[model samples]
Target: MIRKRTLRHFIVFVSVSGPICIVLFHQTSTRSFLKDSCMCNCAMDSEGRSWFSQRYKPSANVTLNRKNGLLDFHTYWWWKSLQNESVVANYTQVVEVMFSLFPDKDHYTDSSPSRCRTCAVVGNSGNLVGSRYGALIDSQDFVIRMNEGPTKGFERDVGSKTTHRVIYPESAVDMGVTTHLVLLPFKILDLQWLISIFTTKHIDLTYMYVKPSIIADRNMVMILHPAFIKYVYDSWLQGHGEYPSTGFISVIFALHVCDEVSVFGFGPTKDGVWDHYFEDFKSDPNEGPHDGDFEGKVISQLHQKHRIMLYKGW
Candidate 1:
Protein backbone atom coordinates (compact mmCIF):
# COMPACT_ATOMS: atom_id res chain seq x y z
CA MET A 1 0.00 0.00 0.00
CA ILE A 2 2.88 2.43 0.85
CA ARG A 3 4.64 1.44 -2.41
CA LYS A 4 1.49 2.18 -4.43
CA ARG A 5 1.08 5.54 -2.71
CA THR A 6 4.73 6.44 -3.34
CA LEU A 7 4.44 5.43 -7.03
CA ARG A 8 1.36 7.63 -7.48
CA HIS A 9 3.14 10.55 -5.81
CA PHE A 10 6.25 10.09 -8.00
CA ILE A 11 4.14 9.97 -11.20
CA VAL A 12 2.30 13.15 -10.22
CA PHE A 13 5.60 14.91 -9.39
CA VAL A 14 7.11 13.93 -12.79
CA SER A 15 4.04 15.13 -14.67
CA VAL A 16 4.05 18.48 -12.85
CA SER A 17 7.85 19.08 -13.05
CA GLY A 18 8.33 18.03 -16.69
CA PRO A 19 6.55 21.05 -18.16
CA ILE A 20 8.27 23.46 -15.72
CA CYS A 21 11.70 22.12 -16.65
CA ILE A 22 10.90 22.34 -20.33
CA VAL A 23 9.66 25.93 -19.95
CA LEU A 24 12.78 26.97 -18.05
CA PHE A 25 15.06 25.34 -20.62
CA HIS A 26 13.16 27.02 -23.48
CA GLN A 27 13.40 30.43 -21.86
CA THR A 28 17.14 30.11 -21.25
CA SER A 29 17.78 28.76 -24.77
CA THR A 30 15.75 31.53 -26.42
CA ARG A 31 17.65 34.23 -24.52
CA SER A 32 21.00 32.70 -25.39
CA PHE A 33 20.02 32.29 -29.06
CA LEU A 34 18.85 35.87 -29.30
CA LYS A 35 22.03 37.23 -27.67
CA ASP A 36 24.33 35.25 -29.96
CA SER A 37 22.30 36.10 -33.05
CA CYS A 38 22.31 39.79 -32.24
CA MET A 39 26.07 39.80 -31.69
CA CYS A 40 26.66 38.05 -35.02
CA ASN A 41 24.34 40.37 -36.94
CA CYS A 42 25.81 43.49 -35.34
CA ALA A 43 29.34 42.34 -36.10
CA MET A 44 28.41 41.70 -39.73
CA ASP A 45 26.71 45.07 -40.08
CA SER A 46 29.66 46.89 -38.43
CA GLU A 47 32.20 45.47 -40.90
CA GLY A 48 30.23 46.71 -43.95
CA ARG A 49 32.65 44.82 -46.19
CA SER A 50 30.88 41.53 -46.59
CA TRP A 51 29.59 39.64 -49.67
CA PHE A 52 26.24 41.36 -49.14
CA SER A 53 27.84 44.73 -49.89
CA GLN A 54 29.73 43.34 -52.86
CA ARG A 55 26.68 41.63 -54.31
CA TYR A 56 24.48 44.74 -53.99
CA LYS A 57 27.04 47.46 -54.75
CA PRO A 58 25.28 50.57 -56.10
CA SER A 59 27.13 50.86 -59.41
CA ALA A 60 27.25 49.65 -63.01
CA ASN A 61 29.77 46.89 -62.40
CA VAL A 62 26.92 44.46 -61.80
CA THR A 63 27.34 42.13 -64.75
CA LEU A 64 24.09 41.39 -66.60
CA ASN A 65 24.69 37.99 -68.09
CA ARG A 66 22.50 35.08 -69.18
CA LYS A 67 23.57 33.01 -66.19
CA ASN A 68 22.19 35.69 -63.87
CA GLY A 69 19.13 35.78 -66.19
CA LEU A 70 17.59 39.21 -65.52
CA LEU A 71 16.19 38.14 -62.16
CA ASP A 72 14.20 41.32 -61.58
CA PHE A 73 13.19 42.28 -65.09
CA HIS A 74 9.60 41.25 -64.53
CA THR A 75 9.31 42.50 -60.95
CA TYR A 76 7.46 45.79 -61.48
CA TRP A 77 7.53 46.06 -65.24
CA TRP A 78 4.19 44.42 -66.06
CA TRP A 79 1.70 41.75 -65.17
CA LYS A 80 3.05 38.17 -65.14
CA SER A 81 2.36 37.33 -68.80
CA LEU A 82 3.10 40.85 -70.05
CA GLN A 83 6.35 40.96 -68.08
CA ASN A 84 7.57 37.82 -69.80
CA GLU A 85 6.54 39.25 -73.16
CA SER A 86 8.29 42.58 -72.46
CA VAL A 87 11.50 40.88 -71.36
CA VAL A 88 11.55 38.71 -74.46
CA ALA A 89 10.85 41.68 -76.75
CA ASN A 90 12.88 44.51 -75.18
CA TYR A 91 15.60 43.01 -72.97
CA THR A 92 18.48 43.78 -75.31
CA GLN A 93 17.39 47.35 -75.97
CA VAL A 94 17.00 48.06 -72.28
CA VAL A 95 20.43 46.62 -71.46
CA GLU A 96 22.05 48.45 -74.37
CA VAL A 97 20.71 51.73 -73.05
CA MET A 98 22.04 50.99 -69.55
CA PHE A 99 25.53 50.10 -70.81
CA SER A 100 25.69 53.12 -73.11
CA LEU A 101 24.65 55.67 -70.48
CA PHE A 102 26.54 54.70 -67.29
CA PRO A 103 30.21 53.98 -66.66
CA ASP A 104 31.43 50.37 -66.51
CA LYS A 105 32.92 50.66 -63.04
CA ASP A 106 31.50 50.38 -59.52
CA HIS A 107 31.31 53.63 -57.53
CA TYR A 108 33.08 52.34 -54.39
CA THR A 109 36.10 50.06 -54.17
CA ASP A 110 38.16 48.33 -51.50
CA SER A 111 40.83 51.01 -51.96
CA SER A 112 38.31 53.81 -51.44
CA PRO A 113 38.81 56.25 -48.56
CA SER A 114 38.17 55.03 -45.02
CA ARG A 115 36.37 58.24 -44.09
CA CYS A 116 32.59 57.95 -43.85
CA ARG A 117 30.67 59.39 -46.81
CA THR A 118 27.52 61.03 -45.50
CA CYS A 119 24.39 61.29 -47.63
CA ALA A 120 21.11 63.14 -47.20
CA VAL A 121 17.92 61.59 -48.63
CA VAL A 122 15.61 64.57 -48.84
CA GLY A 123 11.95 63.56 -49.13
CA ASN A 124 9.13 65.97 -49.97
CA SER A 125 7.08 65.42 -46.81
CA GLY A 126 5.25 68.48 -45.43
CA ASN A 127 7.22 68.16 -42.20
CA LEU A 128 10.17 69.93 -43.88
CA VAL A 129 8.25 73.15 -44.62
CA GLY A 130 10.00 75.24 -41.97
CA SER A 131 12.54 72.77 -40.58
CA ARG A 132 15.57 74.80 -41.78
CA TYR A 133 17.37 71.58 -42.77
CA GLY A 134 18.85 73.18 -45.88
CA ALA A 135 22.32 73.85 -44.51
CA LEU A 136 22.44 70.52 -42.75
CA ILE A 137 21.23 68.63 -45.86
CA ASP A 138 23.73 70.44 -48.11
CA SER A 139 26.58 69.52 -45.74
CA GLN A 140 26.42 65.85 -46.75
CA ASP A 141 28.66 64.38 -49.44
CA PHE A 142 25.62 63.28 -51.43
CA VAL A 143 22.21 64.99 -51.38
CA ILE A 144 19.58 62.80 -53.06
CA ARG A 145 16.25 64.42 -53.86
CA MET A 146 13.17 62.77 -55.30
CA ASN A 147 10.66 63.78 -58.07
CA GLU A 148 9.98 67.53 -58.32
CA GLY A 149 10.99 68.28 -54.76
CA PRO A 150 12.47 71.62 -55.69
CA THR A 151 14.68 73.82 -53.55
CA LYS A 152 14.31 77.18 -55.32
CA GLY A 153 11.85 79.03 -53.04
CA PHE A 154 12.27 76.58 -50.18
CA GLU A 155 16.05 76.57 -50.07
CA ARG A 156 15.81 77.57 -46.43
CA ASP A 157 14.06 74.27 -45.74
CA VAL A 158 15.24 71.96 -48.54
CA GLY A 159 18.89 72.18 -49.60
CA SER A 160 19.76 73.61 -53.00
CA LYS A 161 22.68 71.29 -53.69
CA THR A 162 21.56 68.06 -55.33
CA THR A 163 24.07 65.33 -56.13
CA HIS A 164 21.46 62.83 -57.28
CA ARG A 165 17.83 63.13 -58.33
CA VAL A 166 15.64 60.00 -58.42
CA ILE A 167 12.81 60.26 -60.91
CA TYR A 168 10.53 58.40 -63.31
CA PRO A 169 8.61 59.62 -66.36
CA GLU A 170 5.58 60.82 -64.39
CA SER A 171 7.50 62.94 -61.89
CA ALA A 172 10.34 63.93 -64.23
CA VAL A 173 12.00 67.32 -63.74
CA ASP A 174 14.84 69.05 -65.50
CA MET A 175 18.11 68.81 -63.55
CA GLY A 176 21.59 70.22 -64.18
CA VAL A 177 24.38 68.34 -65.91
CA THR A 178 26.22 68.01 -62.58
CA THR A 179 23.40 66.11 -60.89
CA HIS A 180 23.08 62.39 -61.51
CA LEU A 181 19.64 61.49 -62.91
CA VAL A 182 19.01 58.16 -61.28
CA LEU A 183 16.24 56.75 -63.45
CA LEU A 184 13.88 54.39 -61.62
CA PRO A 185 12.36 52.69 -64.66
CA PHE A 186 9.14 50.84 -63.80
CA LYS A 187 8.50 49.67 -67.35
CA ILE A 188 10.26 49.23 -70.70
CA LEU A 189 8.52 52.34 -72.04
CA ASP A 190 10.16 54.36 -69.29
CA LEU A 191 13.55 53.26 -70.61
CA GLN A 192 12.46 53.97 -74.19
CA TRP A 193 11.09 57.33 -73.09
CA LEU A 194 14.48 58.26 -71.63
CA ILE A 195 16.30 57.18 -74.78
CA SER A 196 13.90 59.04 -77.04
CA ILE A 197 14.14 62.18 -74.90
CA PHE A 198 17.92 62.15 -74.98
CA THR A 199 18.04 61.37 -78.70
CA THR A 200 14.97 61.95 -80.82
CA LYS A 201 12.82 63.96 -78.37
CA HIS A 202 9.70 62.16 -79.64
CA ILE A 203 7.88 60.39 -76.85
CA ASP A 204 6.07 62.80 -74.46
CA LEU A 205 3.14 61.54 -72.42
CA THR A 206 3.16 60.42 -68.77
CA TYR A 207 0.30 61.22 -66.34
CA MET A 208 1.24 64.82 -67.29
CA TYR A 209 3.06 66.44 -70.19
CA VAL A 210 6.66 65.51 -69.19
CA LYS A 211 9.60 67.25 -70.76
CA PRO A 212 10.61 65.52 -73.99
CA SER A 213 14.18 66.54 -73.33
CA ILE A 214 16.06 67.61 -70.21
CA ILE A 215 19.41 69.38 -69.75
CA ALA A 216 21.14 66.50 -67.95
CA ASP A 217 24.59 65.16 -68.71
CA ARG A 218 24.56 61.99 -70.78
CA ASN A 219 27.39 60.47 -68.76
CA MET A 220 25.92 61.37 -65.36
CA VAL A 221 22.66 59.49 -66.00
CA MET A 222 22.47 56.18 -64.14
CA ILE A 223 19.64 53.68 -64.54
CA LEU A 224 18.68 51.66 -61.48
CA HIS A 225 19.05 47.95 -62.22
CA PRO A 226 15.74 46.08 -62.17
CA ALA A 227 17.45 43.39 -60.10
CA PHE A 228 18.45 45.95 -57.49
CA ILE A 229 14.87 47.17 -57.37
CA LYS A 230 13.66 43.60 -56.96
CA TYR A 231 16.24 43.02 -54.24
CA VAL A 232 14.89 45.98 -52.29
CA TYR A 233 11.36 44.79 -52.98
CA ASP A 234 11.93 41.23 -51.85
CA SER A 235 14.66 41.37 -49.20
CA TRP A 236 14.10 44.63 -47.29
CA LEU A 237 10.35 44.78 -47.82
CA GLN A 238 9.75 41.03 -47.78
CA GLY A 239 7.49 41.41 -50.84
CA HIS A 240 5.03 43.53 -48.92
CA GLY A 241 3.17 45.58 -51.51
CA GLU A 242 2.73 46.00 -55.25
CA TYR A 243 6.17 47.69 -55.42
CA PRO A 244 8.59 49.83 -53.44
CA SER A 245 8.23 53.60 -53.54
CA THR A 246 10.81 55.80 -55.27
CA GLY A 247 11.80 57.40 -51.92
CA PHE A 248 12.25 54.01 -50.26
CA ILE A 249 14.32 52.63 -53.14
CA SER A 250 16.38 55.83 -53.16
CA VAL A 251 17.09 55.33 -49.46
CA ILE A 252 18.29 51.77 -50.12
CA PHE A 253 20.39 53.09 -52.99
CA ALA A 254 22.04 55.54 -50.62
CA LEU A 255 22.70 52.76 -48.10
CA HIS A 256 24.83 50.95 -50.71
CA VAL A 257 26.63 54.06 -51.98
CA CYS A 258 27.16 56.12 -48.81
CA ASP A 259 28.85 55.13 -45.58
CA GLU A 260 26.45 57.16 -43.46
CA VAL A 261 22.94 58.18 -44.55
CA SER A 262 20.59 60.82 -43.10
CA VAL A 263 16.96 61.09 -44.22
CA PHE A 264 15.10 64.41 -44.10
CA GLY A 265 11.43 65.34 -44.68
CA PHE A 266 10.04 61.80 -44.57
CA GLY A 267 6.73 60.63 -43.03
CA PRO A 268 3.70 62.87 -42.47
CA THR A 269 3.49 66.45 -41.20
CA LYS A 270 3.50 67.46 -37.51
CA ASP A 271 -0.28 67.54 -37.65
CA GLY A 272 -0.28 64.09 -39.33
CA VAL A 273 -1.21 65.39 -42.78
CA TRP A 274 0.25 63.63 -45.83
CA ASP A 275 1.14 66.38 -48.31
CA HIS A 276 4.25 67.74 -49.92
CA TYR A 277 5.99 70.72 -48.39
CA PHE A 278 6.24 72.24 -51.86
CA GLU A 279 2.60 71.83 -52.91
CA ASP A 280 -0.71 70.49 -51.66
CA PHE A 281 -2.11 68.19 -54.31
CA LYS A 282 -5.76 67.01 -54.12
CA SER A 283 -4.72 63.38 -53.73
CA ASP A 284 -3.89 61.14 -50.80
CA PRO A 285 -0.14 60.61 -50.37
CA ASN A 286 -0.63 57.31 -48.56
CA GLU A 287 -3.16 55.93 -51.07
CA GLY A 288 -0.63 54.94 -53.68
CA PRO A 289 0.06 51.42 -55.06
CA HIS A 290 3.03 51.13 -52.73
CA ASP A 291 2.29 50.29 -49.11
CA GLY A 292 3.20 53.54 -47.35
CA ASP A 293 2.59 52.21 -43.85
CA PHE A 294 4.83 49.19 -44.40
CA GLU A 295 7.51 51.39 -45.92
CA GLY A 296 7.29 53.77 -42.96
CA LYS A 297 7.70 50.85 -40.58
CA VAL A 298 10.80 49.69 -42.48
CA ILE A 299 12.22 53.22 -42.37
CA SER A 300 11.65 53.31 -38.62
CA GLN A 301 13.36 49.95 -38.33
CA LEU A 302 16.37 51.25 -40.22
CA HIS A 303 16.54 54.24 -37.89
CA GLN A 304 16.18 52.01 -34.84
CA LYS A 305 18.91 49.69 -36.12
CA HIS A 306 21.28 52.68 -36.54
CA ARG A 307 21.71 51.92 -40.25
CA ILE A 308 20.39 55.38 -41.13
CA MET A 309 19.48 58.59 -39.29
CA LEU A 310 15.90 59.81 -39.88
CA TYR A 311 15.25 63.54 -39.40
CA LYS A 312 11.47 63.51 -38.95
CA GLY A 313 11.32 67.37 -38.73
CA TRP A 314 8.51 66.96 -36.22
Candidate 2:
Protein backbone atom coordinates (compact mmCIF):
# COMPACT_ATOMS: atom_id res chain seq x y z
CA MET A 1 0.00 0.00 0.00
CA ILE A 2 2.82 2.44 0.84
CA ARG A 3 4.66 1.75 -2.39
CA LYS A 4 1.52 2.24 -4.47
CA ARG A 5 0.78 5.64 -2.86
CA THR A 6 4.34 6.84 -3.48
CA LEU A 7 4.23 5.70 -7.09
CA ARG A 8 0.89 7.47 -7.69
CA HIS A 9 2.25 10.77 -6.40
CA PHE A 10 5.31 10.42 -8.63
CA ILE A 11 3.14 9.73 -11.67
CA VAL A 12 0.95 12.75 -11.00
CA PHE A 13 3.98 14.94 -10.48
CA VAL A 14 5.55 13.89 -13.76
CA SER A 15 2.29 14.36 -15.66
CA VAL A 16 1.88 17.95 -14.48
CA SER A 17 5.54 18.91 -14.57
CA GLY A 18 6.11 17.43 -18.00
CA PRO A 19 3.85 19.83 -19.84
CA ILE A 20 4.78 22.77 -17.63
CA CYS A 21 8.46 22.21 -18.25
CA ILE A 22 7.93 22.03 -21.98
CA VAL A 23 5.95 25.27 -21.95
CA LEU A 24 8.60 27.13 -19.96
CA PHE A 25 11.37 25.82 -22.18
CA HIS A 26 9.51 26.83 -25.32
CA GLN A 27 8.87 30.33 -24.00
CA THR A 28 12.48 30.84 -23.01
CA SER A 29 13.63 29.62 -26.39
CA THR A 30 11.32 32.05 -28.17
CA ARG A 31 12.61 34.95 -26.08
CA SER A 32 16.16 34.06 -26.98
CA PHE A 33 15.23 33.71 -30.66
CA LEU A 34 13.49 37.09 -30.74
CA LYS A 35 16.53 38.68 -29.16
CA ASP A 36 18.85 37.37 -31.87
CA SER A 37 16.64 37.16 -34.98
CA CYS A 38 16.54 40.79 -36.14
CA MET A 39 18.66 43.80 -35.16
CA CYS A 40 16.10 46.18 -36.66
CA ASN A 41 13.00 45.52 -34.56
CA CYS A 42 10.74 46.99 -37.19
CA ALA A 43 10.97 47.89 -40.89
CA MET A 44 12.58 51.24 -41.54
CA ASP A 45 10.72 54.32 -42.81
CA SER A 46 10.01 54.54 -46.57
CA GLU A 47 13.60 55.62 -46.89
CA GLY A 48 14.58 52.16 -45.58
CA ARG A 49 16.72 53.64 -42.81
CA SER A 50 16.63 52.72 -39.09
CA TRP A 51 18.51 53.05 -35.80
CA PHE A 52 18.36 50.09 -33.45
CA SER A 53 20.38 48.64 -30.59
CA GLN A 54 20.20 45.10 -29.21
CA ARG A 55 20.32 46.37 -25.66
CA TYR A 56 16.94 47.40 -24.21
CA LYS A 57 18.02 51.00 -23.83
CA PRO A 58 15.38 53.72 -24.01
CA SER A 59 14.57 54.85 -27.55
CA ALA A 60 15.02 58.53 -28.28
CA ASN A 61 11.65 60.16 -28.80
CA VAL A 62 12.05 62.14 -31.97
CA THR A 63 10.06 63.34 -34.97
CA LEU A 64 11.28 63.06 -38.54
CA ASN A 65 10.43 65.21 -41.56
CA ARG A 66 10.29 62.80 -44.50
CA LYS A 67 10.27 65.26 -47.40
CA ASN A 68 13.39 67.28 -46.57
CA GLY A 69 14.98 64.55 -44.40
CA LEU A 70 15.11 66.56 -41.19
CA LEU A 71 14.75 65.82 -37.51
CA ASP A 72 12.64 68.17 -35.38
CA PHE A 73 13.91 67.01 -31.96
CA HIS A 74 15.42 64.01 -30.17
CA THR A 75 15.00 63.01 -26.54
CA TYR A 76 13.87 60.18 -24.28
CA TRP A 77 11.39 62.41 -22.39
CA TRP A 78 8.12 60.76 -23.60
CA TRP A 79 9.00 57.23 -22.47
CA LYS A 80 11.13 58.00 -19.40
CA SER A 81 8.18 58.08 -17.02
CA LEU A 82 6.48 54.91 -18.27
CA GLN A 83 7.27 51.41 -17.06
CA ASN A 84 9.60 49.80 -19.57
CA GLU A 85 8.03 46.42 -18.86
CA SER A 86 4.68 47.61 -20.22
CA VAL A 87 6.43 49.14 -23.20
CA VAL A 88 7.04 47.11 -26.36
CA ALA A 89 9.44 49.61 -27.91
CA ASN A 90 10.23 47.38 -30.86
CA TYR A 91 6.57 46.85 -31.70
CA THR A 92 5.94 50.59 -31.45
CA GLN A 93 8.82 51.31 -33.81
CA VAL A 94 7.51 48.75 -36.29
CA VAL A 95 4.20 50.57 -36.45
CA GLU A 96 5.91 53.97 -36.66
CA VAL A 97 8.01 52.87 -39.63
CA MET A 98 4.92 51.49 -41.36
CA PHE A 99 3.23 54.91 -40.97
CA SER A 100 6.27 56.81 -42.22
CA LEU A 101 6.21 54.58 -45.28
CA PHE A 102 2.58 55.51 -46.01
CA PRO A 103 1.25 58.97 -46.87
CA ASP A 104 -0.64 61.08 -44.35
CA LYS A 105 -3.60 63.01 -45.76
CA ASP A 106 -3.96 65.09 -42.61
CA HIS A 107 -0.37 66.23 -43.06
CA TYR A 108 -1.32 67.54 -46.48
CA THR A 109 -4.13 69.68 -45.15
CA ASP A 110 -3.79 72.03 -48.10
CA SER A 111 -3.96 69.21 -50.64
CA SER A 112 -6.18 66.69 -48.85
CA PRO A 113 -9.42 66.62 -50.80
CA SER A 114 -12.45 64.62 -49.74
CA ARG A 115 -13.02 61.70 -52.08
CA CYS A 116 -15.42 59.69 -50.00
CA ARG A 117 -18.48 61.17 -48.27
CA THR A 118 -20.69 58.12 -47.65
CA CYS A 119 -19.04 54.81 -46.91
CA ALA A 120 -19.85 51.39 -45.50
CA VAL A 121 -17.52 48.92 -43.80
CA VAL A 122 -18.79 45.36 -43.89
CA GLY A 123 -17.77 42.45 -41.67
CA ASN A 124 -18.76 38.77 -42.03
CA SER A 125 -19.71 38.15 -38.42
CA GLY A 126 -22.70 35.83 -37.88
CA ASN A 127 -24.88 38.76 -36.71
CA LEU A 128 -25.40 39.63 -40.38
CA VAL A 129 -26.99 36.22 -41.10
CA GLY A 130 -30.65 37.05 -41.63
CA SER A 131 -30.81 40.82 -41.42
CA ARG A 132 -31.46 42.18 -44.92
CA TYR A 133 -29.13 45.17 -44.92
CA GLY A 134 -28.35 44.56 -48.63
CA ALA A 135 -30.14 47.53 -50.19
CA LEU A 136 -29.07 49.77 -47.34
CA ILE A 137 -25.46 48.67 -47.83
CA ASP A 138 -25.67 49.17 -51.58
CA SER A 139 -26.90 52.73 -51.20
CA GLN A 140 -23.54 53.79 -49.78
CA ASP A 141 -21.14 55.24 -52.35
CA PHE A 142 -18.15 53.33 -51.02
CA VAL A 143 -17.83 49.92 -49.33
CA ILE A 144 -14.70 48.36 -47.83
CA ARG A 145 -14.24 44.77 -46.74
CA MET A 146 -11.48 42.83 -45.04
CA ASN A 147 -10.29 39.20 -45.02
CA GLU A 148 -12.65 36.44 -46.15
CA GLY A 149 -15.64 38.82 -46.37
CA PRO A 150 -18.20 36.64 -48.13
CA THR A 151 -21.12 38.11 -50.07
CA LYS A 152 -22.81 34.77 -50.69
CA GLY A 153 -23.52 33.54 -47.15
CA PHE A 154 -25.33 36.57 -45.72
CA GLU A 155 -26.23 37.92 -49.12
CA ARG A 156 -29.15 39.68 -47.50
CA ASP A 157 -27.44 41.03 -44.38
CA VAL A 158 -24.20 42.15 -46.05
CA GLY A 159 -24.88 43.15 -49.63
CA SER A 160 -23.03 42.04 -52.76
CA LYS A 161 -21.78 45.52 -53.53
CA THR A 162 -18.08 45.61 -52.73
CA THR A 163 -16.25 48.69 -54.07
CA HIS A 164 -12.85 47.77 -52.67
CA ARG A 165 -11.26 44.81 -50.94
CA VAL A 166 -8.20 45.69 -48.84
CA ILE A 167 -6.18 42.58 -48.24
CA TYR A 168 -2.79 40.97 -48.11
CA PRO A 169 -2.07 38.88 -51.19
CA GLU A 170 -3.18 35.73 -49.39
CA SER A 171 -6.65 37.13 -48.68
CA ALA A 172 -7.41 38.67 -52.07
CA VAL A 173 -10.81 37.45 -53.32
CA ASP A 174 -12.13 37.30 -56.83
CA MET A 175 -13.65 40.72 -57.58
CA GLY A 176 -15.27 39.91 -60.92
CA VAL A 177 -16.57 43.19 -62.32
CA THR A 178 -15.86 46.82 -61.42
CA THR A 179 -14.56 46.11 -57.92
CA HIS A 180 -10.95 47.18 -57.30
CA LEU A 181 -8.06 45.42 -55.58
CA VAL A 182 -6.01 47.57 -53.16
CA LEU A 183 -2.55 46.29 -52.28
CA LEU A 184 -0.92 47.55 -49.06
CA PRO A 185 2.80 46.86 -48.82
CA PHE A 186 6.16 48.57 -49.24
CA LYS A 187 8.24 45.53 -48.38
CA ILE A 188 9.68 43.46 -51.19
CA LEU A 189 8.54 40.25 -49.50
CA ASP A 190 4.97 41.54 -49.29
CA LEU A 191 5.10 42.70 -52.93
CA GLN A 192 6.40 39.30 -54.04
CA TRP A 193 3.43 37.64 -52.40
CA LEU A 194 1.06 40.16 -54.03
CA ILE A 195 2.52 39.55 -57.49
CA SER A 196 1.82 35.83 -57.13
CA ILE A 197 -1.90 36.42 -56.43
CA PHE A 198 -2.40 39.20 -59.01
CA THR A 199 -0.88 38.20 -62.35
CA THR A 200 2.01 40.37 -63.55
CA LYS A 201 -0.03 41.54 -66.57
CA HIS A 202 -2.60 42.87 -64.12
CA ILE A 203 0.05 44.71 -62.10
CA ASP A 204 -1.43 47.98 -63.36
CA LEU A 205 -4.45 47.01 -61.28
CA THR A 206 -2.37 48.03 -58.24
CA TYR A 207 -2.65 51.43 -56.47
CA MET A 208 -0.22 54.00 -55.01
CA TYR A 209 1.06 53.92 -51.43
CA VAL A 210 0.30 57.64 -50.84
CA LYS A 211 -2.07 60.55 -51.51
CA PRO A 212 -0.34 61.40 -54.74
CA SER A 213 -0.93 57.76 -55.61
CA ILE A 214 -4.59 58.37 -54.84
CA ILE A 215 -4.66 61.41 -57.14
CA ALA A 216 -2.77 59.51 -59.82
CA ASP A 217 -5.42 56.86 -59.70
CA ARG A 218 -8.80 57.85 -58.21
CA ASN A 219 -9.03 54.18 -57.47
CA MET A 220 -5.56 54.17 -55.89
CA VAL A 221 -4.67 51.90 -53.01
CA MET A 222 -5.48 53.58 -49.67
CA ILE A 223 -2.53 53.15 -47.33
CA LEU A 224 -2.60 54.55 -43.79
CA HIS A 225 0.74 55.57 -42.35
CA PRO A 226 2.06 53.36 -39.56
CA ALA A 227 2.05 56.47 -37.37
CA PHE A 228 -1.74 56.46 -37.46
CA ILE A 229 -1.47 52.88 -36.28
CA LYS A 230 0.79 54.15 -33.47
CA TYR A 231 -1.85 56.77 -32.62
CA VAL A 232 -4.53 54.11 -32.43
CA TYR A 233 -2.19 51.85 -30.50
CA ASP A 234 -1.33 54.56 -27.97
CA SER A 235 -4.79 56.13 -27.65
CA TRP A 236 -7.53 53.61 -28.44
CA LEU A 237 -5.70 50.34 -27.72
CA GLN A 238 -4.14 51.51 -24.43
CA GLY A 239 -0.63 50.54 -25.64
CA HIS A 240 -0.27 46.77 -25.00
CA GLY A 241 -3.21 45.45 -26.99
CA GLU A 242 -2.93 43.23 -30.06
CA TYR A 243 -2.88 44.97 -33.41
CA PRO A 244 -6.45 45.81 -34.40
CA SER A 245 -8.07 42.85 -36.15
CA THR A 246 -8.70 43.13 -39.89
CA GLY A 247 -12.35 44.13 -39.36
CA PHE A 248 -11.50 46.88 -36.87
CA ILE A 249 -8.70 48.12 -39.14
CA SER A 250 -11.20 48.37 -41.99
CA VAL A 251 -13.39 50.63 -39.87
CA ILE A 252 -10.48 52.92 -39.00
CA PHE A 253 -9.52 52.95 -42.66
CA ALA A 254 -13.04 54.05 -43.55
CA LEU A 255 -13.12 56.71 -40.83
CA HIS A 256 -10.13 58.44 -42.40
CA VAL A 257 -11.09 57.57 -45.97
CA CYS A 258 -14.69 58.77 -45.72
CA ASP A 259 -16.86 61.33 -43.94
CA GLU A 260 -20.11 59.40 -43.37
CA VAL A 261 -19.84 55.69 -42.69
CA SER A 262 -22.11 53.01 -41.23
CA VAL A 263 -20.76 49.85 -39.68
CA PHE A 264 -22.43 46.49 -40.38
CA GLY A 265 -22.10 43.18 -38.49
CA PHE A 266 -19.56 44.54 -36.02
CA GLY A 267 -20.27 43.53 -32.42
CA PRO A 268 -22.35 41.13 -30.40
CA THR A 269 -25.68 42.30 -28.94
CA LYS A 270 -26.92 42.52 -25.29
CA ASP A 271 -27.77 38.80 -24.94
CA GLY A 272 -24.16 37.60 -25.22
CA VAL A 273 -24.94 36.54 -28.76
CA TRP A 274 -21.94 35.62 -30.91
CA ASP A 275 -22.82 34.17 -34.28
CA HIS A 276 -21.71 35.11 -37.77
CA TYR A 277 -24.17 35.02 -40.66
CA PHE A 278 -22.02 32.46 -42.39
CA GLU A 279 -21.98 30.18 -39.36
CA ASP A 280 -25.01 28.31 -37.99
CA PHE A 281 -27.34 30.72 -36.16
CA LYS A 282 -27.64 28.43 -33.13
CA SER A 283 -25.79 29.87 -30.14
CA ASP A 284 -23.53 27.46 -28.28
CA PRO A 285 -23.70 28.55 -24.65
CA ASN A 286 -20.22 27.16 -24.25
CA GLU A 287 -17.91 30.01 -25.24
CA GLY A 288 -15.17 28.96 -27.64
CA PRO A 289 -11.63 30.27 -27.74
CA HIS A 290 -12.55 32.77 -30.48
CA ASP A 291 -15.51 34.03 -28.45
CA GLY A 292 -16.47 37.52 -29.53
CA ASP A 293 -18.68 38.32 -26.52
CA PHE A 294 -15.94 40.20 -24.70
CA GLU A 295 -14.93 42.10 -27.85
CA GLY A 296 -18.63 42.67 -28.54
CA LYS A 297 -19.02 44.57 -25.27
CA VAL A 298 -16.11 46.87 -26.17
CA ILE A 299 -17.43 47.47 -29.67
CA SER A 300 -20.81 48.36 -28.20
CA GLN A 301 -19.15 50.88 -25.91
CA LEU A 302 -17.13 52.40 -28.76
CA HIS A 303 -20.27 52.79 -30.89
CA GLN A 304 -22.10 54.63 -28.10
CA LYS A 305 -19.11 56.82 -27.25
CA HIS A 306 -18.12 57.66 -30.85
CA ARG A 307 -21.66 58.15 -32.21
CA ILE A 308 -20.86 55.72 -34.99
CA MET A 309 -24.01 54.01 -36.22
CA LEU A 310 -23.86 50.28 -35.55
CA TYR A 311 -26.40 47.94 -37.14
CA LYS A 312 -27.67 45.68 -34.35
CA GLY A 313 -31.08 45.16 -35.89
CA TRP A 314 -32.13 41.68 -36.98
Predicted candidate 2 versus true structure: per-residue lDDT over 1-314, tens digit per residue: 99999999999999999999999887655543432221112222322121112211222111122332221222122322222233223433433443344432232222122122577888766667667898899898888777567887566778888887766544555555466455533232333333333333242232323111111222333443333434433444444333434565566555444545688877653355756566655554224322244345445644554324578755
Per-candidate Cα lDDT values, in order, are: 0.72, 0.49
**Off by more than 4 A, model 2:** 1-116, 184-188, 199-220, 269-273, 280-298
Off by over 4 Å in 1: 1-89, 109-113, 206-208, 282-285
Best-performing candidate as measured by TM-score? 1
lDDT of 1 by residue, 1-314 (tens): 99999999999999999999999887655544533222112323544334344334444322232333254545545323322333333666565765665554444443233345678999999999889999999999899999999999999899899999999887889998899888887766777777877788987875458778888887777777667777787677777777789999998888777667899988888888888888975346557568888899988877776567899886
> Candidates' TM-scores?
0.74, 0.51
TM-score of 2: 0.51
